[model samples]
Target: MMASSDPAVIQTRALSKRYRTVAALTDCTITVPEGRISALIGPNGAGKTTLLRLLAGLARPTGGDIAVLGTAPRPDPAFLAGIGFLAQEIPLYRRMSAADHIRIGAHLNARWDGTSVRQRLEGLGIPLGQAVGTLSGGQRAQLALALTLAKRPRLLLLDEPVAALDPLARRQFLAHLAEAAAGGGLTVLLSSHLLSDLERICDHLVLLAGSRVQLCGDVDALLAEHQILVGPRKDTTAIERDHTLVHAVRTPRQTTLLIRRNGPVIDPAFETADVSLEELVLGYMGQHADGPSPAHLSAIGGDQ
Candidate 1:
């Protein structure tokens, strides 16, 4: 978890977006500290894309407030220069070659580093002169990433960047992404459904489900705060009274629960165990699959 003293690179308070008949996001409040690789995970249509669009200044929020790098996101050159956004489709000119894209990037971006980007593509064995349309899906994804990184943006936003790639290609893309993030001075908010992949490189977590943030915090701290309790099928009144229940399952003779521990579980009937990242995420998702209960909404973790 980031210390309270650390400066926030991204902050949102009661952020929301609506499209007439549909609400894309609602009351999302989270703070991402500078230089942290944060994972934004949620099921499809959970407003992950809408949130990224809002952060990138591509779309305006219907309500609430947002701040990126100490100011609201805008379309101005200075603000755009400090942020890079790569949508799921990996927008690029398919008719143009990789070199051509680099040339265009240099002209459009004030802080472009075409030399480094070209070298990166060359090192990957990607043909710089070939049209991007002829390249593999993996190659195009890499080229888009390289161009985005070359801008030297303070914040990077990626929306399901590797969803269409093969396993090996996904691994390769993440390796390159990990390398870039290791250089410091970069704050990344990556949206992906691959929990295992996100766990490998992300320290901070923002879980959006049912069009709202269910959990947002440091992965380690969140893990430590939650526990799985397995016990005989019995009345849960006492357990519920002592802890914040995130999810529960009951069989004929056993009852298992995922709970945010409030204090010591002094009851001898229940056995406690640590929860994994996947378990924690699924538990919360299952709990809020229909929509968050009033109690669950009030107990959301992390800032706001």
Candidate 2:
């Protein structure tokens, strides 16, 4: 459960992971507050999977430190039980029936809620006699989620859990996820490239690019601090003096500027529009593409 002190549920300082010659993650650091749904996003080959694996204690870091639920990532059974992970593949025994899976879950988890799991599967119209191999992709994903939630974990880690589901299925999955979190103090860290679903469910955001954390903070606060200015194509000398320009694109007639506003935008020539979560994420990613790696940013790990 979340404490009144508001301690960060997950924290990493200079955390790094390497596989032979490849550095999957480099000097990464971020903080996730308890009970918030945080979206971890990045392009392909951006180390998103590697970071999730590290958090799950499936792999050890080559350097730095990471603490989840106030302890370092480890293979301890008790620590593992406190975390419920649903991998992207949605691994399940193809030969087993849905009832068999439920039985297995109850046998493995100390806090498994059999009644809740049974009710969830039944409500979704997943037959207890149906073989896992015969279930649809969406049904399989739902089943995986049901099993995880039944464990009543404090922290839930989902890696692209909805990437394979259809729009309707995605909606249903997120709705169920929201209810689960609201029912208890569940902290979630979900990685996905689907920004649409993320914006609908996540209250916090973490952007990773070039094997580093590009941005991390409360979603609303981050949005409030960023704005996209559209105006005539001209020198941005005046605007640059007041705001941090994240990215800028200019055409013959118009200019679009993605800036982090430090104060009010008093300029009348420029029409400012609220930046959506997608735009904000893309802007940061664009900046990453144009600028140096996050290693150059001295305060990369600090509060945004």
Candidate 3:
């Protein structure tokens, strides 16, 4: 059994899931530390949904182990109360009013905050008397989030929560999410393809590509460890020996490399530039592009 006091709110060891003959997630291992927003990113069909569903206790893994909030994901009411999940569809009863949904949520959650939920809807100008089906996309999104927040969960799992919202609506929703996370004792794991938005709100990142965990770590720490070096075009044999190269490009006049450096650089010919979150994610995604899959590195080693 994993320790209750383990800093990671979620942990998986060699976790995998298969849909018939197709493997959705393979040999996956990762950790999502507590009290911070962690973004799960990957390209289409990269198993982001499968991983999130497993964590949400909606699906069972075919192999390996997973623990949510220190216990195995379970369907028991006591266990379910600790987690709140919002899927990409954001399902709500079409004929129900905002008040009706609030009442239903109060009955369903042991720690439901009805008053707070009502205030959030009202503050957002979501009418209590209007049927949900009549609400705008942005309004419905707000309503879905409010309901989830009212559950007062220990960990919130969001699957592309803002994928359909407009720019202004997306900002508003994230602002509310940030405020809720700031209020202590709540941890969030959200998956999205929007790298720019993730950079704005997420403190930690887990990047999956080809159904594998390519990178996972604190956003700041990972960025600091990986650097982009620009220098004159030369043989990369020596640098490749020390640094784990992710991606490299060269022209007749210059060369630039995205590398995971374990030590201080003493090379006089190269100038190191900071790597952005998008660059880091893309570098890992491109790891398998040019040749056979690169052997996995222990840059930010997984829980396994």
Best by lDDT: 1
| Best-first order by TM-score | 1, 3, 2
- Flag the better candidate by lDDT, 1 or 2: 1
TM per candidate comes to: 0.95, 0.91, 0.93
* Candidate 3 Cα deviation (angstroms), residue 23: 1.1
Looking at model 3, residue 44 earns an lDDT score of 77
Give the per-residue lDDT digits (tens) of candidate 1, residues 1-304: 3455669999999999999979999999988988889999998998999999999999999999999998999999999999999999998999999999999999999899999888999899999999999999999999999999999999999999989899898999999999999999999999987677678999889999878888887888889889999999999878877888888889999999999898888779999999999999999888878465675665554324
Better of 2 and 3 by TM-score: 3
Per-residue C-alpha lDDT of model 2 across residues 1-304, encoded as one tens digit per residue: 1123557888888889989999899888888899889999988778888888889898899999999998987998789888988888999999898889999998887778878878988899988788999999999988899899988888999999999999989888998899999986899999987677788889988888888888887898889888999999888878876777777889999999988787998888899999998999988888777774453243233323
Q: Tell me the spans in candidate 1 whose CA falls farther than 4 Å from its real position.
A: 1-3, 290-304
Clashing pairs in 2: none
In model 2, which range of ten residues has the least summed lDDT? 295-304
- Model 3 Cα shift for residue 53 (angstroms): 0.6
Q: Identify the leading candidate in terms of TM-score.
A: 1
Query: Would you list the C-alpha lDDT of every candidate in the order shown?
Result: 0.90, 0.85, 0.85
Q: Give the candidates in order of lDDT, highest first.
A: 1, 2, 3
**Comparing 1 and 2 on TM-score, the stronger one:** 1
Give the winner by lDDT: 1 or 3: 1
